[model samples]
Target: MNEHPFAEFIKILGKGKKGSRPLTQDEAYRAMTMIMNDQVEPIQLGAFMMLMRVKEETPEELAGFVAAARESFHHDTQTISADLDWSSYAGKRRHLPWFLLASLLLAENGIRVFMHGAEGHTEGRIYTRNVLAILGINAATSIDQAARQLQENNFSYLSLEHICPKLYDMINLRPMMGLRSPVHTLVRLLNPFDAAYSIQGIFHPSYRQVHQKAALLLQQPHMAVLKGEGGETERNPDMDCLVQSVHYDELSEENWPAIFERRHIKPEELNPQQLAQLWRGEFSDEYAEATVIGTAAIALKLLGKADNQQQAEALAQSYWNARDKERFST
Candidate 1:
C-alpha cells in the first residue's frame, strides 16, 4: 500500500546508532506535521516515540517540530499576539509555583503574557492550571477564549488539553510508554501564539542550551531559557541561575546571582491555597517573595521594561509592592 508513508520515519529513527542520525530541520517539520495531523499508524507512532526518547531531540529537530506544531494550531500572526510566551509543562514538586505570581506581576504592569501547559501527564507535582483554578482563573478552552482572557486580564493560561489535544495525547503516553517523548520538548518550544518574547524553564540543565539554540533557529527575536526552580521558570533564591537567550536575532547568555545566602528547605507538604494567600498579602514568606521578584525581573528585562538586571529587580519589586492584594482573594 504505497510502502506506508510514515514507515520511513520509523526507519530513519530506529536505524542502529552508527547508521542513524538526527533528522534535518525540514524532515523534522514534515514528520511532526504528520504526527500532529494524526496520519501515522499506531505501531509507527510508538516506534518513533521510543526512538526519539532514547536519543533525545537535537535543536534543529526541535525547531522543526515547533514549526509543525505552530502550523497545526494555525498560530496566525494577525490574530495571536502577546508580549511573552511562557511554557510551564514541568509541574512543581518542591515549591508552590511562584512563577505564577511572576507572570501576574508582569501582567499587572501591562505586559500581555500567554501561558500554556499540560497537566496530569505526570504525577506527584502540582500543575499550573490546577493552581490557577484555585486562585480564581479558569483555564481557556480555545484560542478564541484565550485571546479574550488576555485582552481582559493581560494574562491567560491555555491548557494543552485544549490547545492541542494531539500533543496532550502524546504527553499522556508517558504512562503507557514509561518515558517521555519528544512531544515534551516540542510543546515547550511551540510558542503557538508567536509572541515577541518567550520564556522557558527546563528541569535538566543540559536542555537549557537546546531550547535556546532551537529558538535561534526558529528566528525568535527574544527568548530565554533557564534551569528554573522545580522547572517552572521561578528563580531559586538560594542558587545562581544561568540564562540563555536570543536577543533581537543575536544569542547571549547571562548569570544572575542568588538572592539568599541560606537555602530555605522545601516544605514537606505543598499547599495550593498559599499561592492565593501570598498574593493577597495575608501571608509572607521571604523565599517565595524573592522567587517571585527574581523570576519577574528576568521577564521584565526580557520584555525591555528594564535596561539592566538591577533595574529589572527594582522595577519588579515596585510592581510587587503595588499589586492589588485582594485581587485574587475574591
Candidate 2:
C-alpha cells in the first residue's frame, strides 16, 4: 500500500490542531487531487476541510486547490472554450445581485451569457431560481436547455453538479461542516466552456486570484477576477472591488495579471419593494446606475482595457453615473 498523504491529512484534521503545517502550492495541489478523487477516506477528508477553513488559504495555496477542482471534473478544454464573456459565481447570497439582470441586459445587447451555480450550498436568501421566475425565465434549464436560453435570451443558469459532480460535491461540504471550505475557490472560478473572457467574484479577499489562476491554467483570451464584501468585520464592506484583467498573450508577462485594484464603490442600497419594482420595469434611481456600470464594464473589456485603459475605464464609470439618474428612472 502506498504511504499516502491521505493518512497525514486525516491526522491534521482528526488530531485537533497540534500545529497545522502550510503545504506548498504544489503540495496542496496534489493533496486536493487525492481527496477530490476519493483516494482519501471520509474522516481525513473532513479533517482537512476543517483545518483549511480555520487557517484561511493563501494565494498560491488556493491556486493549486482550484486546479485540482477543475481537474476533478475531468473537464475538457473544449467545454471551457465554448464561448467568450463567460461569467460564473458561487450561489447567490442574501442580496441576489443584478447579475441575472446584467445577463439579460448584456444578452439583449448581443452578449452571450453562460452562468453556473449550485443550490442549498450556502445558507442565505434564495436568489437565482426565484429571480429567474420573476423574469419569466425557468431556472432549471438543462445544459441543452440553458444553451438554448443563451441562444434565445442570452442568459443561462447551469447547475455545477450537472456539469461537474465532484467539484459540486466539494463545495456542498462547506455548509455541511458549518465551515466555508477552500472548495469555494473552485466554484467561483469554474468556466465550464472555458470562456476567453470571464467576470467572477469571491467573498473572501484572499482567494480572489485562485479564480484568476484557474482562468490562466486554461489560457483564456481575457479574464477579470474580483473580491466582494462579506467576511468577518462586515462593517468594512469591500468598498469597490479588486479587479485583475488579463490577456492570453500576456499570460507569460511579469505583470500578466494586470491589477484593476480596489475600486471604491458606493453600491446603492435598495430595499426589496424598490428592487421588485425595478425588476418589474418600474425603474428606480439606482437601477439606472446599476445598468450603466454593468454595461460599461463589458464594453471596456471588449475594447481591450490594456492599451487604451484609462479612457476605457472613464467610459465605464460615466456609464453608471449617467444611468444612476435616468437609465431606469421612469
Candidate 3:
C-alpha cells in the first residue's frame, strides 16, 4: 500500500511528548505548501492543524509557513509598493477599531498601507471588513483590485478569503476545533505583498517574542508586534505598550509610556460611525484620540519618520490634527 504524502508531517507533530518535535523550516514549508495546494486530505489536515496547535508553532515553523503562504499568493507582490502591512484579525469587542483610523491617518500622509484580515469566524465582535464598509470603504475582492486601490487611495484591505481561500477555510474551522489553529498565528505573518514594514497585534503577550523572532527568521526588514487592545494593532493609550521589532536583521524592543494615567471606561455601545466622526473632528473622545495617535506613533517610529517615541507621538499628533476633516463625509 502506498503511504499518504501528508501523513509524515502529521506524524512529526503528533508523536508522544518525548518524541514529538516541531518541524524544520523546510518541512514546515513543504507541509504548508501541500495544505495550501489542497494536496492534503480533510482528515489529515485536521490532524496536522490540531497537532500544531497543541504543540504551538516555533519561530522557524512560522517563518516557513509564511514563506509557503506568500508563495501561494496569486499576484506579483513586487508590483505592489506598500510602505506598511497592517494585519487586523482579532475583532474588537471593548472598543471600536481605532486602529482603522490610525491606518487611515498614515495613508492620508502618503504612506501606502496594505491591510488584511478575516471576519465572521467569531460572533459578537466587530471586524475590520464590516467597519470599512460602514465607513464607505470597499474591501478589495482580488489582489488586482487591492493593488489598484493601493495606488489610488494609498490604503487597501484584502480579507483572508481573497488573500488565500485555503487558509481562510482553515481559519473558519476554529469553531469546530474548539480553539484557534496555528493558521491564526501564521496568517498574521503572511505579508503577501512583501511589504517592507509590517505591524502585528496580539492578544497574548507571549506571542510578541514569537512574532518578533519569526519576522527575524523571515528576514523582514521592519516589523513590530504589540499586545494591542482587543488583539488588534490599536494601542491601549492607558497602558504602556512594549513594542518588539526587527529592523535590518537586528532584533530590538522598546517600551512606550502610557498616554493616560487613568484607564478610560469602555463605551457601552460600539458605534462604527464614531470612527469617522472622530476623524472629522465632529466627535471628541480623549481615549479614542490617544489610541489613534499612539497606534500611529508606533508605526511612524517603525517607518523611520521619527528617531524616538516622543518625536513619533508628536508627528502622529500633527498628522491627526492636520487630517482632512471632511474626507469621510458623505
Candidate 4:
C-alpha cells in the first residue's frame, strides 16, 4: 500500500537527526491547514505535534502555521477590528489573574481588547475563563457575538473552545501525551481578529524570541511578548520585565524596572471572587494592584497612549482609579 498522505508529513518531521529538518514556510502552512481541516489521522496528528515540540518550531514555521490558522478563522473586518489581541493559555497558579483587571481598565479607557484562552487542559491552576465567569462576563460562542460584546463593552473574550476547537482539542492532548505540544506556543500567536496590536506571555524565557520573530514574520504592526507572571500576560510587579516587541515592522526590546523594592509573596490560595470585589472597590490588595497597574502600563505604551514607562504607569493608574466600581457588582 502507498504510504498514507499524513504519514509522509510525519516522516518529513521525524526522519532522523542529521536527515530531518524544519518545515519550510509553505510546508508548515499546508501541514497545519491539513490538521485544522481534520484531514490527518489522530495518531499521525499526535506524532506530528510531539515531534515539532521536541525539535522546537522555527519562526518561519510558526508564522506559516499562524497563517493557516488565521485563514481558517472567518473574521469579518467590517464588523470587528480589535485594537489589542491578548492570548491567555497559561493559567494562574500562584495568584488570581490581575491581567483581567488590566484588560478591563484598557477597555474602560476605550481600547478594544479581544482576549482568548483555553481552560481545563492542565490541572492545579485557575484560568481566565473561570475568573471571567465569576465576574459576570460570559465567553463569546462565536466571532459575531464577540464583536457585539466588544462594541458594547470595548472588551470581549473568545475561548479556544469556540474560536478554534480543533486547536483546543490539540491543546487538550497534553494530558494524554504527558507533555505540551506546539499548539500551546502557536495558539498564543493566533491573532484571531487581526488586531493591530497583540500581546503574548510565555512561561519560558527563551520562547520570547520565538514569539517576537514570529510576529514579525506574520507582519503584526505592534506586538509585545514578555515573561509574564505565571505566564498569562500578567506582569509580575515585583520583578523587572524585559519586553520584546515589534513596532511597525521593526523589532526592539526594553527593560522596565520592578515597581516594588521588595518582592511580595504570592497568595497562598487564589480567590477568584477577589477579582470582582476588587473591581467593585469592596476589596484591596497591594500586590494585585501593582500587577494590574504594571500590566496595563505595558499595554498602554504599546497602544501609544503614553510615551514612556513613567507616563504609561501614570496613565494606567488613572484608568484604574477611574474604573466603574459597580460594573461587575453583580
Candidate 5:
C-alpha cells in the first residue's frame, strides 16, 4: 500500500474544503499514487473528484497530475504516417459523433488520425473506436502495432485502456462520480505522433491557453483548438461552432493561436436531433449542408491548400454539398 498517494489524496480533498490551502503538484502526485494503485477507498475517491471539480484545476496544477498518469503507460503507433495527427476526447453526451466521420475523411485525404475515449452513451459504448470498426478500420491490437500501422497506413487509435492503466481504471468512477476529472484534459494533450500537424477539439474555452502552452512544451508542428459547438461535442450543430487554432509554422516551436472561424450556420440546415435519433438506422439525409461546408473549409485551411479561411469555407460548403448529394443518390 502506498502512503504517499493517500497523503496527496487527502490534501486535494482537504484543499477543496472551506478552510485549506490549495494542493500543489507534490501533493496531487502523492494522492494520485494511492488512487491509481487502488489503495484508496471508493468513498474517498469520489470525495476527491467532487472537491477538485468544485475547486477547479489549473494547468500548472495538472502538470503533476498528467505527469504521474503518463508515467505508468507506454504506447508506440507505427501505422500512422501523416503530417498531422487528429485527436479529441471531450466526450459527447448527445448528437451524432461527426469526429469519426471527419477522421475517416481526413484519413481518406492522406492525413493520419487518432482518437480514443472511454465508453459513453446510455448503452455504455458510444465511442470512436466502435465507429471506426463500423467503418471497417481495424484498431491497433498493441502499442507498437499502432505505431507501425501509423507509419504504414497513416492512422491508428489507442484507448485509455491501452495508454494508461490507471486512467482507464477511473472509468469505474464516471458512473459513480457523474463528472470527469483531469483525465479528460489529459487525453487531448497526449500526442500519438512524434511531430505532426495537429487539430484538436477541446472541452473548455479556458483550455486554449493551456493547449497553446502544451503545444510549445510538446514541440508540435501545428495545432488548432476549437470551442466546438458551444461546449458540445464535434456534432457541427448547424447552429454554431467556433474554431481557435495554433499554428507552428516553422523552425520555431512557438504556438500561433487564432480563432480560425466562427460557426454561425442555420440549425435548420441539418436536423441535428433527428440525426441522433436515427443513427445506425440508415445512411440518409446527406448530413447538415452548411456545417459540412464549414468543416470542410477548416480541413482545407489546415492542409494549406487555401490561402485564407473565407475562401476555404466557401469551398467546403459547396464541395461537401455536392459530395453528399452524390453519396445519397448512390
Candidate 6:
C-alpha cells in the first residue's frame, strides 16, 4: 500500500511526549503548503492542527507557516507597500474596537496602514469587519483592492477570508475543535503587503514572547507585540502595558505606563457608531479616548515617528486633535 503523502508530517507531531517534536522550518513550510493546497485529508488536517495546538507552535514553525501562507496569496504582494501591518484577529469582547480609530487616525496623518483580520470565527465578539462597515468603510476584497485603498486612504483592511481562504476555513474550525489552532497565531504574522512595521496583539501574555521570537525568525524589520485589550491590538489605557518588540536582529521590550489612575467600567453595550462619533469629536468617553490615543502612541513609537514614549503619546494626541472630524461624515 502506498503511504499517505501528508502522514509523515502528522506523525512527526503526534508521537508520544518523549518522541513528539515540533517540525523544523522546512518541514513546517511543506506541511502548511500542503494544507493550504488542500492536499491533506480532513482527518489528517485535524490531527496535525490539534497536535500543533497542544505543543504550541515554535518560532520556526510560525515563521515557516507565515512564509507558506504569504506565498499562497493570489497576488504578488511585493507590489504593495505600507508603513505598518496591523493585525486584528482577536475581536473585541470587553470594549468597542478603539484600535480601529487608532489605525484610522494614523492613516489620516499619512501613515500607510494595511490591516487584516477574520470574523464570525468566535461568537459574542465585535470583529473588525463589522465595525468597519458601520463606519462606512469597506474592507478590501483582494490584494489589488487593498493596494488601491492604501494608496488613496493610507489605510485598508483585508479580511482573512480574502487573504487566504484555506487558513480562513481552518480558523473557523475553532468552534468545532473546541480550541484555537495554531492558525490564529500564524495569521497574525502574515504581513502580506511586506510592511516595514508590524504590530500584533495577543490575549495571553506568554504569547508575547512567542510572537516576538517568530518575528525575529521571519526577519521582520520592526515589530511589536502586546497583550492588548480583548486580544485585539488596542492598548488598555488604565493598565501599564508591556510591549515586546523586534528591531532588525535585536529583540527589545518596553513598558508603557498606564494612562489612567483608575480603570473605567466597561460599557454595558458596544455601539459601532460610537467609533465614528468619537472620531468626529461628537462623543466623549474618557476611557475610549485614552484607549485610542494610547494605542496609536505605541504604533507611533514603532513607526519611528517618536523617539520615546512621551513623544509618541504627544504626537498621537496631536494627530487625534488634528483629525478632520468630517472625513467620515455621510
Summing lDDT over every window of 10 consecutive residues in candidate 4, give the lowest-scoring window.
70-79
Q: What would you estimate as the lDDT of candidate 5?
A: 0.55
- Candidate 1 versus truth, CA RMSD in Å, comes to 1.3
Give candidate 2's root-mean-square deviation (CA, Å). 6.1
* Candidate 3 residue-wise lDDT, 208-229, digit = tens: 9999999999999999999999
Q: Give the TM-score of candidate 3.
A: 0.98
**Candidate models: Cα lDDT each:** 0.89, 0.56, 0.93, 0.90, 0.55, 0.92
TM-score of 5: 0.70
Predicted candidate 2 versus true structure: per-residue lDDT over 1-330, tens digit per residue: 776667765444345466556666677788888877778878777777777777776655666776676776644555332344434435434343555544454455555667776667767644455555554567644556665676675667777777777777877876678877777655665566566566665666555565556566555567666553232101122244345555774532111122333433444443434444554546564433343344345435543542453565465555433333232333
- Predicted candidate 4 versus true structure: per-residue lDDT over 1-330, tens digit per residue: 888777766888898998789998888999999998989988888899989989999998999998998788766766687999999999989888999999999999899999999998899989888888888888898888999999998999989988888898889988999998889999999988889999999999999999999999999999999999888998998998999999988999999998899999877787899988888888888889989999999999998899999999999999888889989876
Error of 5 at 280 (Å): 16
- The positional error of residue 107 in candidate 2, measured at the CA in angstroms, is 1.5
lDDT of 2 at 158: 74
Q: Kindly list the per-residue Cα lDDT of model 5 for residues 88-107, writing each as its tens digit.
A: 45444444456554554455
Candidate 4 error regions (>4 Å) = none
- lDDT of prediction 6: 0.92
Can you give the TM-score per candidate against the true fold? 0.97, 0.71, 0.98, 0.97, 0.70, 0.97
Record all residue pairs in model 4 with backbone atoms less than 3 Å apart, i.e. clashing.
none
lDDT of 4: 0.90
- Model 1, 1-330: lDDT tens per residue? 479888877778878978788888999999989998889988888999899888889999999998888887754557866889999998998889999999998898899999999988888989999999998888898889999888988999998888788898889999898888899888888887889899999888999999999999999899999998877887898999999999877889999999999899888899989888988888899999999999999998888888999999999999999999978866
Q: Which consecutive 10 residues in model 2 have the weakest lDDT in total?
A: 229-238
Q: What TM-score does structure 4 among the candidates reach?
A: 0.97
Model with the higher lDDT, candidate 2 or 6:
6
Candidate 6 per-residue C-alpha lDDT over 47-102 given as tens digits, one digit per residue, 9 for 90 to 100? 99999988898888998898898889887767887999999999988899999999
